[model samples]
Structures are given as structure tokens and as C-alpha cells.
Target: TRKVRRNFVAEKYAVLIDALYGGRASQYIETQVSYEDGRTNKVAAELRIEDAETFPPGAVKQAA
Candidate 1:
């Protein structure tokens, strides 16, 4: 797993990372921000692992 950081401010933003194997998306990470209310906004982040080589089986770990 990898960690990415952005230093900026915006009203809406999206970040996506896709790992491709065999010409297909085997793993991905996504983050999205959208307006939800006048004072608050919706924020989401997702990580999906489908390949064993990319995401090994064992105790899950996060990159620093």
C-alpha cells in the first residue's frame, strides 16, 4: 500500500490511483469531496484490493 498527500484547498476535489495488471485495474484507491450541506461537505476515501501480488495476505498494514 502507498500513501499520497496533497497540500491544497478546494471546494471539490478527487484523487484516484489505479494499479493495472494484465491490462485491467487490479487495485485502486479513490478519494472524493463534494458539497453536502451549507456548513459541511461530504468526504470519502476508498481502497480496493483484488490482486494478491499487490495486496499480500496477512496482517493488513498501512504505509507511512
Candidate 2:
């Protein structure tokens, strides 16, 4: 008699790696970045971006 192997066993044994690393279990809030001026910048939600269409009528260039 042949032994019955389960194909579902492999699918259930998949390993999931989390962002956790080292002895510290804290999650990173923002990534550390830098500018061309040799100054570092902390990335946060405070950054503001104006929509291109919301700019003043004459502020943007139009296609000739």
C-alpha cells in the first residue's frame, strides 16, 4: 500500500519574514534620507505637494 502524501502541507509551512530585526522590536517611523547640501532629512507626512492643476493660471507653462 502506498503512503498518502499531502500537498497542502507545503503550502501551510511557508515562512513569513517581518520587518522586525535585531534585539529591537520597534517599527521605524520614517526613513533617514539626505540632501545635496550634506544635511540629513527625516521623511515625514509634513511634506506638502501642490497639484499641478491647482497652480495659478499663469504659473504653469502651456504647450505651444
The lDDT leader among the candidates is: 2
Q: What is the lDDT of residue 19 in candidate 1?
A: 32
Clashing pairs in 2: none
Question: How do the residues 1-64 of candidate 2 rate in per-residue lDDT, one tens digit apiece?
Answer: 5765565433432221122222333333444588899999876432232324477768979899
Q: Give the count of colliding residue pairs in each prediction.
A: 0, 0
Clashing pairs in 1: none
CA lDDT scores, all candidates in order = 0.42, 0.45
Model 1 Cα shift for residue 59 (angstroms): 34
lDDT of 1 by residue, 1-64 (tens): 4554453322213222223333444334344445556454444445453555455677678689
